[model samples]
Target chain A: MRSKASPVSDRSKGQAGWGLKSAAWFGVLYLNLPILFIILYGFTTDDASYSFPPPGLTTQWFAVTWARADFWEALWLSVQVAFASMLIAMVLGTFAAAAMYRFKFFGKEAVTLLILLPIALPGIVTGISLRSAFSLGDVPFSYFTIVLGHATFCIVVVYNNAIARLRRSSPALIEASMDLGADTFQTFRHVILPNLATALLAGGMLAFALSFDEIIVTTFTAGQQETLPIWMFGELSRPRQRPVTNVAAIFVMIITFVPILAAYYLTRDTDDVAGSGK
Target chain B: MTTTGAARPRSLSNSFSTFLYQRPRLVLALLLVPPLLWLGIIYLGSLFTLLAQSFFSIDDFTAQTIYEPTLATYARLFTATNLSIIFRTLAMASVVTVISGIIAFPLAYYIARFASGRMKALFYVAVMLPLWSNYLVRVYAWKLILAKEGAIHWSINSLGLGPVLDWILTLPVVEGSSLSTSYIGTTLTFVYIWLPFMVLPIQAALERVPRSLLEASSDLGARPNETFRKVIFPLAIPGIAAGSIFTFSLTLGDYIIPQLIGSSRPFIGQAVYQFQGTAGDIPMAAAFAMVPIVIMAIYLAIAKRLGAFDAL
Candidate 1:
């Protein structure tokens, strides 16, 4: 029985190794294929509708996308929303992080949980709740409400980054500054702010990217205002402007790719920062 | 400890220093106030109002009238059809979570264990690139692939196995034959969309497993399988839980994927969309929204019990 079990275990180990490799390759291809297709189709001049392998290749759609005013309007709206959301998220998240990190206050855990709750809950719930809240309060659904909704979730991203950074920073630095006769504002400016700079920037970048691509919450909050995602949604449902939808998607890809890549790098070094806390 | 004239000024400064050390509290409050108020007023406030709206009956199918309180919407939600919708949504979410977890584990393992600096960065970028793309565009891209004359069918036809394909295609359960707009498509899309969320957290958790632990296990004559099962898996469970919460909750609340791919069948998300958008029954929509919230609350409670919330 022992001999039989040993051989079976050996055989299973070999199978597991091969299985892991195959799965890894398959997973990589699955993720990359749609992105590759999107990039490839951007150059295709399929006027009627999009096909996987276009019969002809041309940059005409790119020209058409460039010349379109609606595209610009949607892109502008997206930028406005993203920027507004990021600003609000950074300020609120920074303060929240600072409060949670520095102070021993009542309801500190509850406050942190509340802040994180919006993110942990599905976007749909957030959207629905916001929609209901706006209607209940008789608040008009507009750009401001959209900004508010996006910022709710975006704050979580910023807070995660900020709090992580704050935890990593040594308390001795602040104590040293105080002993050296620096004021709170001076210490913040010279020490705390500089230490938090990379985290804040990374958080802001991630917030911007998230807000830029956000559709679910925007759908609930933006009554008439059309962000790029909303515009793309409308375009896709109505088949007349299918290629335009592809064009808008390509634009989204370009806008989001750089910042998201940077965020990944920023977060990849998470262990180093986390270790610093100890 | 001196309280004389010279010591008085030093004490005053000491008090000032203490005040300065804790000034972040006031700053935090000031910073947190606007966003917190925004959430309180716009998010939680709306949720309460929505719940209230659900109790009030719609009068004459026009402006919702608060004439009488009833549980009609809740009753409607419990109907066999709506129950099926709820079940389907939950089932799809479960499947997506499990499948994405399975697919993500190895990739995450590879990144965390085998890959180093540049390769890690490249792989990380590859994983997240899809997330940055327009959600609608990604759905539409799938539409192009899944359509009748799309890539899948084209590839099959081009291989000169057209007859064999046709025979398989003629099968009742084949996607083109009345099954295209089924749970399969919706589940596939959910898996694709939420895979990254699962990957990142699991990878992060796997990376946290101490190298010394693995070395110690191997030194003790434990094989790779034993090391992973005994040491790595336990540490990574919290991440797996976080990833599951993300994938499951997101898929549950998503109306767009099912609307785009799933046939005329209504998932909870689409039911809410219809209740609010098409049917104009805001109260019913709000009630439907609670389905996912309840599920998530339960999930969070469980996750908290498992210490997953700390990792977040």
Candidate 2:
């Protein structure tokens, strides 16, 4: 009578099924609540204090954020940085993956580690280091420095995606092209490029999304220059500008959100997404 | 295929392709050089430069960093205030990491083993969507949530849990600051910001666990609890470890959450920023920055030993 036995199933089917589902939903809700706040607050008629229930809903702040020249300038700077970083990342990342994947190389592991280092290390470390290098070398903080800082991590995104895609692709596809008397460049253009196109694009979109919203590294690299995030960070200190700031933040969310969504859809069929570690 | 009667217009491309084919090593070099130069010279070079700068000390009198090699700046990091900040930051990161791990594991397990294909994709998107949102505003939203007149306190009071919430708020390290102005607030914000980073890798790891093994354990008379402890936990440790890398490191390095939520106590990131930006003490900032670097290096090393790199 004192023996405790369990009617245990091997499948994790009925073990706290409803409880776990609700817990999972709770996790998702927890993750999105702040974002929901951003969206909600953006429409608030109140501009100063963040009341729990925003007094009223208005699209006035969106218009205000859009009308501000400063907002456009910051948005433009962010776009430039994101675009430049994505281009640099795509080219370098795709090439690095192709080279390392195709050829036998010495110190390959070291190379991989080096590529991963910027992202693997803390962003503040990268930020401070870039600042140090700039000051020492008499390099001014400019768009170039910002892009360079972004490219470090953005390249890794592309590299991870490309390498995973390359590894998964059949070597025989390239071999078939070569066997048919096609040259290396021709084979690559015909077989390899087609295979890697979506992955690299997905990677680039992800990289672009990252660069667009990057705050920590951009904070150090952008001197007297305000990217959208930098501008938003500045806005946080201004108490009167709460609605405007929320509106701008909402704008950024909607902008970067698209690329991220596109990147997800593009990589969904693939077994591994770069930063996703899947 | 026409042998000798190939189109004359394709000659340039054919020759170029042939030229590339004849020199595979040259092609490899061409492909490898540009990216290597960019990452190696620009990124790693900057890091080395930062490390070298950490050896220099700032002169308060001249307000310039002395170019001489000295560990004085590194030694400067041992002050009571700085050490307190470091300890607070480390404690916060540890708590956040543990909480995130606990919360994320079940959610990840559910997504991996239970969710349908459509549901899995939705969960993945949910996990990553927050990562793309503007980070600063997210912290600000938490500021509102934890404010005295905000949703949390309001709900707590309305739900008859006011005293309970107050008692918890008055507990150690968070006394008198209210929810919005305390380390509790900071830790909450950091955990919220970084929770997504905790979910994906763990989900991937759980997904990779073979179903046959679970059936095998059951067949061997092992209960679900025993199976989880003996098999699932050990295998999933690496994924948990990997997830922790992002949560730990991101929390360790973040300055914004502390600024927006916590009282005026400085964390490592804020200290570094203030030292460099406001105080013009680059060397001291560099030295302070090394705390996180050293911590993450050790963390990564341990994680690597645990096979977290495999998950990555």
- Considering only chain B, report the TM-score of each candidate against the true chain B: 0.86, 0.94
Q: Each candidate's lDDT (Cα)?
A: 0.77, 0.85
lDDT of 2 by residue, B1-312 (tens): 455425434677788877777889898999999998998898889888988889999998999889999989988889999999899889999999999998898889888877865777788788888876667768878987888877788788889999998898788878645688887788788889999888888987887887669889989999988998998888888899999999999888888788888888888999999999999999999999889999998998999999998987
Candidate 2 colliding pairs: none
Q: Which ten residues in a row have the lowest lDDT in candidate 2 chain A?
A: A1-10
DockQ of each: 0.40, 0.51
How many angstroms is residue B297 displaced in model 2 relative to the true structure, after the best TM-score fit? 1.6
Residue-pair clash count for candidate 1: 1
Could you give me the TM-score of model 1 versus the true structure? 0.89
Model 2, CA-based lDDT: 0.85
Could you give the interface RMSD of candidate 1 in angstroms? 4.1
lDDT of 1 by residue, A160-242 (tens): 89988888778888888766766677788998998888889889989999999888889999989999999888877775645
Relative to the real complex, the DockQ score for model 1 comes to 0.40
User: Best DockQ goes to which candidate?
Assistant: 2
**Candidate 2 lDDT, A126-238, residue by residue in tens:** 99899889989999999999999998889999998899888887777777777787766778788888878889999999899889988899999988899998998888888
TM-score of every prediction relative to native: 0.89, 0.93
Where model 2 places Cα greater than 4 Å from the true spot, the runs are A1-16, A271-278, B1-12, B15-19
